[model samples]
Target chain A: MLFLRDFGPTEVGGFGISSANDLLLVEDIELVHQACSAVHVTFHDESVADYFDRQVDAGHTPAQCGRIWLHTHPGNCPLPSSTDEDTFARVFGKTDWALMFILARDGATYARIRANTGPGVQQELSVVVDYRAPFAASSESDWEKEYLANVHDAALNTKDTTVKDRDKSRSDRFDEWDESDFCDPLLQTQLRGY
Target chain B: MKVLVINNDGGGFADYMDVEPNTTVATLFGQVTKSSRAEDYLIRVNRQPCAADQILQDGDRISFTPTKIEGAAS
Candidate 1:
């Protein structure tokens, strides 16, 4: 999934699925359908609900499927953008724990985990690829198909890649961020026509 | 009555606590989340969605998790 960012002009995202016993050990990175731009990505609301349903059907708890959110940046900065920060605060704030992981095209990375049980705690985490763990064989074709199905790149007209425009665009182009429908699991169920 | 409180907000923790008899989920939610709105969270009892007025029982497990989380770039 990390390699797919190189194939497009937009950012990509996926959930890091882990077992209940080892919540930090990502067993799989599951990509869902989303719209993407050079600097923005939003998962389809129904897609997220469906993903949770599928995970539950497979015997994984919702916490296991939902705690770790992983994404890629098309630029060199792996630091959380203002929008990313807001998203993390508003969305993951209430979870018992949630992790945000970012990978930039230049190979820089960022990760943070937050726990909310008592006094809230937030900590930065180091990223490493653990190759020693036994892994399943990967199929390039399947990954390509997954990428093609999920990542719909909307052309970004602006040439400015600086932090100024990124901050400015948060208010101008991100009206959707204000809406709870896209992020609310209850609304997600309603949107799925359940 | 002792109940398991699995707060999934900041610094997520699960612990057993004593509550007054007949304490409703709404009452416990108010105590746990403080100023936060209940509508913003998915409150559960024994792993199922619960009504705010549902009375707490001894050994009941309660959890409060945010129902919405967004990912964005700016």
Candidate 2:
């Protein structure tokens, strides 16, 4: 079961997560290479490249291949766009499974879970806020209230129907592939599909 | 020299270690596989494909992502 929570303070970013069995927790959000407009958010692969390196250095494994894509909707509709689905399909789809979490300024929320285990698999589930078992954190403080008060209201009247993709070779040094030397002997055979 | 190492094997393992100044990627990888010859790992340095003989830098970031499937949770 894919699960997540509200990230009210995030402007627009992404993160690699650490999960405990069925539960998902934000190890930390990587606030890098974010191209944010009222309609959508785009994350440059560089934004997450080092974060992944750091995450692995800390002893985390890929078995927690689970991911949570956090973004906000500019309008009242909290559903994902076709491009969003495609993004999930191409990037996160490589993993066995992952989740996407969407938030709207109007308080509308949406979520989708995708898996590549056996066949075509993807679904949009209800974003039920569990006020009963509230998040273990401090309540909104006065400064937080003032900050939230000044936030723009549903800034996007229209949604972006276009697709925003990251750079081609995230593994590129300085954003360029090193094809000059013998990088790997089995490179061609292994990366045939990718 | 110091290099950052990341492996997305099971859960995953990221760490920093010292290596010879001119150590090649394959040489370092050889150390990582415990001297066993496993070739299915996707090796990248600073987000770029590196040759087996690619020399190490003082602060290069290296990562290894296994091609094996993680399947579903139990």
Candidate 3:
């Protein structure tokens, strides 16, 4: 909650990690390197792939590591935006099941699960926080490190720009730049979703 | 032949399904996922990544999981 609140008006994205014994029980939140604005977050694809491999190496399945997509909504409305819906459809459409969850700044939240097996079915889910379960003590320092490492806020200096304008600017910048500026050459090939 | 199919896509579930003899992983994937491309998923047999043409055994375990997911805000 504190991590979600720390970003204030900018959005943050993470994955809900659950155990094999209980898929619906989100035991942890895992954040990867991403470039985020107030309305969209583009995860570094290689980082996500690496995270997936790590989870598999640790004996966790991909479903346990990546099924639940969680993000924060800077506005009061927690409803899925067109971009959110489009992303959900494109990325998770083939999965047997997937979950999308959003938490708004005003404490409002929205959650839904989509099942694609047999006949496709989607149902809204209620958000619940189980306080009775044992959890690790809040590590502000660790969170700070994670947040610093993963979240590159595109809104930091572009606060005056509208979301659309920021997006356009980013696209324009990309068009003019070359892959040499990127830290990894693979990033050039993996920049598909934003 | 009955094989354990564990689809790790959305609601990851493990279930037993009867397959015809000599069914390949590619054939089973096409049957279950219908329109999904084989390249978009990681198909494994008995916990190891297998070739699409690999034939399933009577008690083999199979799983399919997507390789990419993108999360966005409104």
Candidate 4:
């Protein structure tokens, strides 16, 4: 089942909303389950970019592939902020079929679904999860299961070479910096959603 | 030691405060929520779901956020 929440009017450019369902369902149910169990979530720039490129290559119109993005926040508030808006514009600007979801520690979450309505203008629909339910167990033929297993195994093994290299550089830099130069900034702003 | 207090409802900014060691999440909540109702916000430690009674550690990231916010398309 899919869930959505309606934002009355505080959202800029349109109503802001969020969702918690799997995005692969927009493609195929079997694929969705395969993705959940077989695919591991990883953060690598090229991996993410290739994932998007593959969607387009798979013949999904820019609007039908429907991308889902998730991030965690420290607090419970589920509202998106100006920074979120800027980030969303940069990330999803090219895709009319993207959905953004923000998960917060407070069990609060938000999502917004975007689709093209016409040329130069688009519509964003909001949805929120009322409650989280257990994902159903799936059964697949031996061959299908094996295929998914292989795909996921390979994806997981894909190395995050960039992150490792960057971390190494940062570590070396930290060793050279004066400890007193690192002062924590005062946080006076409220957490905002994206 | 100084810790960051971020409230999502007011803005997506972080603030630093000097806090004592071994402070419980509940204790910090008390300090922050003194002017507001406790029920109005949700708090998390280190980006994970945490309970009020949970103990806080040094360098832990604490975020306070509302349960939900709705806005119409502008």
User: Candidate 4, residues A31-135: lDDT per residue as tens digits?
Assistant: 111111111222333223233234434543323332454443334565565555554554454343555565444466676756533553534445543345434
Best by TM-score: 3
> Which residue runs of candidate 1 sit more than 4 Å off their true CA positions?
A155-194, B1-70
Per-residue CA lDDT of candidate 2, range A15-122, in tens? Answer: 435444433554433333343445555554433455465555565555443366666665666677775666665556645667776666567767777766787588
Which ranges of candidate 3 are over 4 A from the true structure? Answer: A155-194, B1-72
Model 2's CAPRI class? incorrect
| Stronger candidate by TM-score (2 vs 3) | 3
In Å, what is the interface RMSD of model 4?
17.0
lDDT of 1 by residue, A26-83 (tens): 9888887676777788775546655654565576665777788888887788888887
TM-score for chain B of each model, two decimals = 0.88, 0.77, 0.82, 0.73
Worst 10 residues of 1 chain B by lDDT: B65-74
- Per-residue lDDT of model 3, residues A16-101, tens digit only: 88867888888888887666777777665556655565566577776787688888877788898887787688767756678899
Note the DockQ of each predicted structure. 0.23, 0.08, 0.33, 0.01
Alpha carbon lDDT at A66, candidate 1: 76
Model 4 over residues B1-74: C-alpha lDDT tens digits? 77766542211235667789888887987776442455444566665668877877777777654432211111
Candidate 4 local accuracy as lDDT?
0.41
Could you give candidate 2's per-residue lDDT for residues B13-73 as a string of tens digits? 4667889889999888877744343455557898786788889899998876433211110
